[model samples]
Target chain A: MSSSSSSSSSTELSIPLHVKYIQSLGENKDDLIYHMTSHLRLNAIYWGLTALCVMNRQDALDREEMIAFVMSCWDEEAGGFGAHSGHDAHIHATLSAIQILILQDASDKIDVPRVVNCEPSKHIFHSRRTLPEMLTEGLPLLVILSLQQPSGVFAGDAFGEIDTRFSYIAVQSLSLLGQLDKLNVDKTVSYVLKCRNFDGGFGAVVGAESHAAMVFVCVALLAILDKLDEIDQETLAWWLAERQLPNGGLNGRPQKLEDVCYSFWVLSAMSILGKLTWIDADKLIQFILSAQDPENGGIADRPGDQPDVFHTLFGVAGLSLLGYPGLETIDPAYCLPESVTKRLGLRKNWKALPKRT
Target chain B: MPRVTSNNSDDEAQLYCEKSEWQDITPIPQYDGINPIAPIFYTPEYKDATEYFRAIVKADEVSERVLQLTYDIISMNPAHYSAWQYRYRTLVALKHPLDVELELMDAFAIKFLKTYQVWHHRRLLLTALRSSAPSPLSIASKELAFIIRALSTDTKNYHTWSYRQWLLAFFDDEELWEGELPYVERLLETDVRNNSAWHHRYFVVWGRVRAEGEIDVGDVLKREIAYTKDQIALAPNNPSAWNYLRGILEHTKTPFNSLRTFVELYSTQTAPGEEDIVDLDNPKPGPGAQLPCAPALEFLADIHEEMGGEQTKKAIEIWKSLGNEYDTMRKKYWEFRVKEALSV
Candidate 1:
């Protein structure tokens, strides 16, 4: 397990060790880092669980306990889950909760009617009774639509801070809830289109510089809305391919240091564009493997940085997109496993690298 | 519970916590430190902070004491957004002066320039002060100066730039808009590669364009194009300038032929060379000549395609050289461009 030995060999993903690392994340409740990260607890759980699923070790963590934690984070007032119990509900945590539930095949546990009716003014007037009935009424759709600003971007919540990230979150969340048709699709697309910079890459907001993470969110948003044709794909793909650095890692923007998370952001966008081959996959694989904590069983942002759940999930997801052996194929558009997305009939026309032998 | 006895044998150290709480948590055994049972597994500082935070949460108090506690927590971990939230609630509940809170945030900004919570807290304080401040525009001017100092340190700090934009939009003063261009010009003069400055320039100029209905956008585009050309002349390989040039062209809907003429003239002045055919497969020319004016070459290819026929064929040859020799890393992209041009 020495770094030198691991580096000498064709660095393969240590699935068992990574699984153990992810499983150990929730063990030390008394640890300050654990409590300090309470605000990101649900998101961390999603990252860990998704990484495990990509590693084909979905059972590494106890499913029942995980589900209970997600449910505990439900904010009764907001009718959505918060980052942690007693935290205010946010669109981000709500999406993570929904994603975790869907992946666990436990979407049934969600009190859909209760969530939909959390704001009675939107739903009660619709005269719908059951969850499906309310959905068709488009009451929940109004709840999400209300967060959109006049600029076509979305705020994370009623607090009114906006980012293109929230735009994608709204799109994905609404799509998952079967309310995509109710969204002002043209308005949403226009907002995203406004975020596009001269480099043909999307930014966090209008007039912002192109960033890899924002590119993924915008591209995925467009893909979900069936507006992929609106973007200058060749220019964007070129900008994305240029993210790959000499060491085979991807940076978020030009003149930036390469990070492991960009592996997912850049690779996912490329996958969606059917241009994954534009990057040197072998070098990227080696770089990702090098970022692994050989002894600690998690991936870091870079080769020597401390490992975190965020990087670990992104590293594995990138590998999944790269068609690494023995890993579940992750839907680049959704960041969910292909099987789960397929089951939900949410898979879009995106490509992942062919699985290696 | 497992207890460890000191060498003095007179004192016994209690187990950090009951084992059941951390049943499956593997303790790091390498370090011999305080709280040996939890050594390497958890830092003592974090445990103390959490306990303090929990006590505050439990008490549900909004007092000077709570503010101090939250400050200590934030000082230890600025990324603790919950700590900032608690501090904000306590400050509001205690009727703390918005200006005082803003001043405190300025201090925190110096220490934690890149922390999102710090910038967000500043935004909240500024929003609260908007109505009460004697002259809100003056306060915005002060805030703008403060942000400029920050951008001077780290030109590409997105949070700082975003906050600056938020502040400008918050004021929405016509006078403030006039000052933005010169401010951005000062920044760009210092470093032409600062994309944040370039973006801010575009934002302010576009805002002015939108505000003044009669302003000639064609004139503005020409001026911006000239400015970008000057910047590109200073550092031809700088992507920010190149992108800025393209942004103006796209915004103005100016013909590619105009850009082509501009670039062709500029390139010859910068790096004179014959229009000799370059081998697409071979990496022709040395490094110095390859990238001195890449954006110019790229634009040339675009113009050639638009012109069609012989120009399209010539454009393919230039793209090959640019792809293979100048921007080798983006060879596939350039090749794709070549293919696209051929089809056209």
Candidate 2:
């Protein structure tokens, strides 16, 4: 409970995990996979980071080993990804793999057309599609392929239901690649809008409970679509602000304990919308720094735990998004490594295209 | 039940066992002397390094003394689940007691439930506990209860719920366990926006059913959905109740009753995610412009048919309030009639 004093700024050293394990989960056949502990949404986040790690400049050999471990759990026949190999083909894993592949720069390795809005077989969207088109073309196609049906929302596997949160993932995956146009944007938008609950943030889908994590996806999707103006700014921001506890970490849900990861999800969206000012930046950064591996130079998902590559990347990403010193200012719309984005000279403002002919 | 893994060693199992009880152990006299204690293994010189081989790497062991020192160093943090985890993570197939240790491995598991090490440790602990001599049921049950108690403190505790579900399945008897389904329902009553409780409730239903063996899932889910509606009726502004209801209603085999409840509950949630301007030009508008009340109008139209009566009219009002722009809201404007048929 002790606070960081002026004397401790230089004295504090933070270390998130240095490696991430982005393993392969699905294919037309089985491959290497890592069994997720449980909870699909979280498992997906880990896989997402693993995929991101394959591209990290600082990722160590253990990162590759971690990815290999996750890949070992893949169910080759499902033609998609899962938290672990042999587990169901959840959209969470599928989208995670796609992003990781994008990070790996192995986007070509994936049969893109077949996955994005390509019914039964189309993976590649024509080059003419807007950044939204190209993005929506590939990822949501996989989401469509994976949909359980009648719901129009995405299912984790073919057999799973069209759960709410993933609609955010499915849509965000498209947004990440700049392809919101490939799918029926109206339908996707409406579906996501319905998932909004009394709490003023988006949930997994219609009538689902609003959660801080899903709020991230919901706001992120809208932000990517150039539709930030659509959300209930006051209500959503209140919810986001309330997520910060007396201790300064963000929790995904109420009465729930806080985690370092939520700081990224909840605050990043707030940062994008200009609502993070209420959060104690100094305290949040301190909480994040405390979660670092005192032994190694990375972070654990929470303090007093072992460091993993996923949390390490995100913890740093969260701090970077917070405009922590030395770290580059993060671009939320595009989750590009701030350092890389800064080097590439990207702007903080997320831009949208004009009317499509 | 051990899956393919990188850990397969007696030393790994031994360290996991010792880590479970280090919480009550004596503190190192030197721990207070240093701001952070480095691994004692790194400082001590090894005598016999040949025994440290992990088998997969085909390298000689770092030395038994080094291994013991590392094990002891890792054991210092009773809650360092991954330290205990990585110690056994060499081949990924290490023999370990998963449930017992996982029950004891609360801090790390609770804070970082999604980590590979926490999970692998739990899985190893469970697998080992199941195979342990005489089986520590009392120990296992006590830990499960602790998880449940911790979950009660925070319903959205995914890690606690996940691990608790794993244990309930092994323990069996929904009738015997009374499962926490009713408690979840009660919590929902108190706070319609309680997502963690609702999430935990979903797993509770799943766990109870596995224990009970074929209770009416649809009827039960319907009851659960009603619980959300009750929340909505009380706090129309609460989005969590609607989200919880939506989670229950969206899936097929989702009882019509639950579907009914979602439509019933969604009345207040219609304009969610909005706190500023509402442009009449685009009733659906853009993100953050206004609450998403208009976009759900059509979906509500469909959902209300299942709900019947005033619920349907309420759905129409929600739709009409979005402003009188046009016949449809689509990018390419798929003929709704044709698209509906094709989509079906």
* Best candidate, TM-score: 1
Candidate number achieving the greatest lDDT relative to the actual structure: 1
Each model's iRMS? 9.5, 17.9
Mark the regions of model 2 whose C-alpha exceeds 4 Å error after superposition.
A1-78, A81-89, A108-149, A176-179, A338-357, B1-344
B1-344: candidate 2 lDDT, tens digit per residue: 44323233444434322343222233222112222111122221111111121121122223333234334433433222323433444323443344434544576555554443454355455545655737556556666666655666666544455556556656564442564666666766666566666655654654234435457767877566555555544554444555455555554245444343234323333433466455332222223332333223434555654575656555445444433332222211223222333343
For every candidate, how close is chain A to the native chain A in TM-score?
Answer: 0.91, 0.68
Model 2, A270-316: lDDT tens digits are: 77677666566677777887787665455677788866546765676
lDDT of 1 by residue, A1-357 (tens): 435455543387888889999989888876768866776888998999999999889998888777766765655445566776545567788789878988888765543322221233443433314334444655445656888999889977655668899999999989888778778888899989988877788878766778899999999999888889998987889789878887889999876889999999999999999888777788899999899988878999999889999999999999989888899999988899999989989999999999996
Positional deviation of residue A114's Cα in model 2 after best superposition, in angstroms: 18
B212-325 per-residue lDDT for model 1 (tens digits): 566878778867777776666566667777777777777777777886545774444244444645533212233254344666788777788878888888889888987788
Tell me the TM-score for chain B of model 1: 0.78
Mark the regions of model 1 whose C-alpha exceeds 4 Å error after superposition. A1-10, A28-32, A109-152, A181-187, B1-96, B211-219, B259-293
lDDT of 2: 0.49
